[model samples]
Target: MTQKLAGRTAVVVGGGQTPGATVGNGRAAALTYAREGADVLVVDRDLDSAEETAELIRKEGGTSLAHRADITVEADCESIAGAALDTYGRIDILHNNVGIVPAGRTEDLAAETWRRGFEINLTGMWLTCKAVLPHMRHRGSGTIVNISSMAGLLAGGETIAYNTSKAAVHSLTRSLAIEYAPHGVRVNCIAPGMMDTPMGVDANARAGGVSRDDVAAQRAAMVPMRRQGSGWDVARAALFLASDESAFITGVVLAVDGGFSLRAGIQ
Candidate 1:
């Protein structure tokens, strides 16, 4: 009901909503962290969108700042982390929510598109972690929550590039967890299933070749809950990882799907 991450500083990469009613996972996670008493840093490629999320947090009486950076680039990642450290003095949580799902099969996808998917979805997390881990390790405590997807755990048809990138993130999470556990840094990942976010809708629109509503319905039907998940579902799980509530948890890929990962088939 109240602050679980008080006095913590959280950085949420890709915290920006696209042009629509739906908020992105990063935006929701940033707000949730703020509401739980963490000073939030909302990072995105688009300055305006990141600022919009930061404004929302400020409006809710939470401390927040916005930083625009291309997460795919090492220099940008370093600058963003530097700014956060300058502003907040320390970092307690790093949430990697940057991802892009380009629609393509292995052969049909252009080399550039495939590279871009890996650049943002996989390499971006690596860069952010690289930039933040030193500071975290120096402080002797931190939590890193990387947002992977169900596509990583299971096959995502026709989106080989995106799927592979997410799978790589899962591997990265495990590697970091094992290496950093002795230093008191917890590394984990969230593999969200089909969620009702703008990015999810865009991914469905591009890959499924149908209206967003139809895609939503089809995804809901695949879930045992008879409904799709919301951004808050992932956000809440992230909060647990970011807070001390999950102190013993590390190297875990928590699936925030609506029982979709559990069932064999609807039958």
Candidate 2:
């Protein structure tokens, strides 16, 4: 273990995943942080899945704890932060990996569906950061990684609220970074594109009633790299942002896409 994060405590929101075909970015990041020597706090709405991630870390000789949290709820976010402090005594890295990807046209999508998209994708991230910022400020130094999406940077014909909300996340990250830099806290965002994770592949497959393989090929062709990204790809990008390697970096939106955003290119 390189121990890039030795003696640190990481709070990974949405860190529980039972990917059917591919690993989720949240789980991959949790495992990566633990492997790199940070005690991890795996927080997910799914208690069983969160426990699974925590147990895996313990089995690998890494320190970890799991908690169930509904980040969209302000009180739950508060509890999540408290849990991390109570267990680890201090917080060093906060990974906001919780989000949803419900796609629909604005006019066709139910109003509630549109609102729920923003609630989970944008509001949840904000609330969690709000809960963690106080602790990070008190510590005098900390890192926060917000996961956005390429869809945020460049949306297709129809995205309803998912794309709009993620775009908001980018703005939120920049503002937080600038505001907190004076407090010795750094904030950045990772905009992932078309990962082969369960959310990207398996979920799409089921939703479209198409074969997983078919959806995978279609997504791969859309990527300029000719291959879809994996959860590990996003995890690696996050590791850099979370670790001291990016000590001088803040308020940057680092893309984890395989040239997909470039193909879309500042549109």
lDDT of 1 by residue, 1-267 (tens): 489989999999989877645777888899999999999999999999999999999999999999999987899999988999999999999999988877777778899998888888988899999999999999999999999998887776688888888989999999999999999999999999879998887565765678888877888898889998989999999999988889999999999998887884422
In model 1, the worst 10-residue window by lDDT is 258-267
- Against the true structure, candidate 2 reaches a TM-score of 0.97
* Per-residue alpha-carbon lDDT of candidate 2 for residues 1-267, written as tens digits (9 for 90 to 100): 689999999999999875568789999999999999999999999999999999989999999999999998999999998999999899999999988877778678888888898899988999999999999998799999999999888765478588888899999999999999999999999999988999889988998999999999999998999989999999999999999899999999998888888888764
TM-score for each model: 0.95, 0.97
Q: Looking at model 2, how many pairs of residues clash?
A: 0
Clashing pairs in 2: none
Candidate 2, poorest ten consecutive residues by summed lDDT: 154-163
Q: Which candidate leads the pack in lDDT?
A: 2
Best by TM-score: 2
